[model samples]
Target: MNWRNFLAPYAQVVEELKVKLKGMRSQFEYESSHSPIEFVTARVKPVSSIKEKMKRKNIHMDNIEELQDIAGVRVVCQFVDDIYDIVDRLKSRNDFEVIEERDYINHKKESGYRSYHLIISYPVETIHGERKIIAEIQIRTLAMNFWATNEHSLNYKYEGRMPEKVRTRLKRAAEAAFKLDEEMAKVKDEIQEAQRIFKTNKESDD
Candidate 1:
């Protein structure tokens, strides 16, 4: 199969979603409000990883469309509440239909993975017509993102068969991260106020 041709639409979905999400952040900045979206990033899964996942999941090449994460968008926010706020916004968007949702924050994985996952069906205009594809969006706080990033790296290093001790340590780290987020939430209002003041001062200085 033509991998590039097949992945083209997924790439378009990632780019379009990134632009729209970043635009949301821009809008919050313009209003001088705390943006639930601290940042937006997106990517189309690579051919190698796609093939690996398909083989692992027993998915046929003909059913490649069944893989929801071929296109991924990650929105990192400041606090846990911000994650839910972003999820609500994403659910309300008309550009894409939210087909599934997994609240990993409230129901974390056994490996201590915590993120709110949304599977969305997005339509991309092609030369022939519009084609709908499934994409995954992950919303998580900064602490969650940091811990998850490290856990991902460790998982890659261990090839998913992590040592028992390493797994235990990771779980502990995840808890610590969540605790940090909780503490930050307690002072969220103060933090936002200070940030707004700093931003205002910076703008005046320029």
Candidate 2:
């Protein structure tokens, strides 16, 4: 297939998924005082990236279906509990079919990466017909996202082979990020109350 033909369905999946996932965040905010989702972002994998990943994974060039993350969505939340809440909500939804799940939160990767990942197949309407594409959804806390983003940047700079000292520091930073999430969970109510009071006082002043 031509590049445009190959990527068209995945592109549509990314756009629709972003809207659907953001709607989930808005729904939570409307239903409760504290919304779990902090923010959501998405992307369709570039052709260069897809080729690099296929080569890295030793997948045959023709095995495009083996590439699960052609479309990727990231949902960042404020609390650890919120991660699971968002996953539960995704599982309950019918718009997409959840095919697999990886709980990196409970079992962190050796590199200290942590997040809950879901592989979903979503059907989108096209001129020809409905097309189903595999997409990956990653959910993590804000602190986790911060640490992961920095680590990813550093990894890119190091070209996937960081020195031992830098690796050790990254591991420690990951632990600190998780610890911060733990502490935030303990005082979530107080934090919410403070936010409410701040909003109320600001409204009164206005």
Candidate 3:
């Protein structure tokens, strides 16, 4: 199948999901004074990158469906607990069907990566009618997002063959980031209350 034929639908999925998820965050901030999500980011993998990943993972060209992250959304939160809360809300939503979940927070990778991943199949309407595609949603705290973002950048620089020095530093950095999240969790209630007050005053000024 020509991947170009898939691009428009994939873009539709990314844009629609990004809006819907961000809207959920806005609603929660307004109604509960506590939003589990700090921010949302998304992407539809480039055709070239997808093809490269398929080759690297030993996935056949015909089995592109096996790669779940072609359409990806990432939800960043302030505290680790917030990650699961957002995931729970996602699971309860009807717009998409949750295919699987991976809790790397409780079970970190060998590289000390931590996040909660959800694989979902979402239906999108097109001229050809309805089509469903698997999308991956990765949820993590801001600290974890920071670490992952940097690691990804460095990995690309090394072409996946990271030097031992950088690898060791990344491991240390991951530990430090998680520690920061834990520390923030200890005072989350206080921080949230301050945030609500600031937002309320700012709105009043407006």
Q: Which one wins on TM-score?
A: 1
- Between prediction 1 and prediction 2, the one with superior TM-score is 1
lDDT, candidate 3, 1-206, per-residue tens: 76778778888899999999999998997789888988999999988889889999999977878999999999999899889898889999999999899999999998879999999999999999999978999999989999999998998999999999999999999999999999999999999999999999999999
Give the backbone clash total of model 2.
0
Q: Candidates ranked by lDDT, best first?
A: 1, 3, 2
**Pairs in clash, predicted candidate 3:** none
User: What would the TM-scores of all predictions be?
Assistant: 0.98, 0.94, 0.97
- Runs in model 3 lying further than 4 Å from the true structure: none
Q: What is the lDDT of residue 130 in candidate 1?
A: 98
- lDDT for 37 (candidate 1): 84
Local accuracy of candidate 2 as per-residue lDDT tens digits, 1-206 = 59898888888999998998889788876676788888999998889889888888998968988999989999999899999998998999989999999999899998899999999999989999998889999999999999999998999899899999999999999999999999999999998888778767887999
- Rank candidates by TM-score, best first: 1, 3, 2
